[model samples]
Target: MASGSKWTYSQNKRFEDVLAEYAEDTPDRWHNVARAVGGGMTAEEAKWRYELLVKDVELIESGRVPFPKYGTPPGEAAAAKAAARTGRRG
Candidate 1:
């Protein structure tokens, strides 16, 4: 995935857990969190993903959108496109 774009559930969960280990208001905290996430994640990417998650969660909680589950296509259109690419039936 691109930086400043989508984040997987595991990534987000790891970010949350790792974020708590840092002291309150630590400078360069996002860099540490990115390192903790591993897989060549950049600090800017981690910070952007975290902020995106917060906004998405807020929208979901407020009934603006449904909560997203891991590994599921965003919608039927996406699912159909994926199925076509994989030559699989939906």
Candidate 2:
């Protein structure tokens, strides 16, 4: 709960949940998000975190950042592996 401490996984998840509960136009949204996020997070910190999250989403949506390929299909994975071995683009 120290100032400038990094948010833990649980804290981030809770922040996302609480943020979803409060709309952008909601009164005192950042205050409510901060209180729900707990860990002594202030409204300013919550707003800052929200801004960072928005930027991250924008970057991902713009395709400047590659999306994670967690559930790639088996055939696609095999093809990519073969392409790599043959020094070819998939």
Candidate 3:
């Protein structure tokens, strides 16, 4: 996480989305994510933020932390809604 500036929910969601699209663990991949994140974030900073979110997501999934109800983080709700509409699992 960037201690220099707090990341809002929307920013974190954007990071998660970009991370998913650029899935591979590579220097270039992090740079791509950073570009998507914008705000002059460097690849190193993006990587740090990503790792923090990954851990939080794992904790949430494992019931160590409550799933955030503030808003759907990224995939979960969107997929569920799409599945409901299509009458198929997302």
Who wins the lDDT comparison?
2
lDDT, residue 83, model 1: 90
Better of 2 and 3 by TM-score: 2
Q: Among all windows of ten consecutive residues in candidate 1, which has the lowest summed lDDT?
A: 68-77
Off by over 4 Å in 1: 4-9, 69-90
Candidate 3, residues 1-90, lDDT tens digits: the string is: 453687787886788888888978665997898888888889888878778878998999999999978876567888888899999984
Clashes of each: 0, 0, 0
Name the regions of candidate 3 deviating beyond 4 angstroms: 1-4, 25-27, 71-90
Candidate 1: residue 10 lDDT (0-100): 68
Give the Cα-based TM-score of candidate 1 against the true structure. Answer: 0.60
List per-prediction Cα lDDT, in the order shown. 0.78, 0.83, 0.81
Which model, 1 or 3, shows the larger lDDT?
3
Per-candidate TM equals: 0.60, 0.68, 0.64
Q: Comparing 1 and 3 by TM-score, which wins?
A: 3
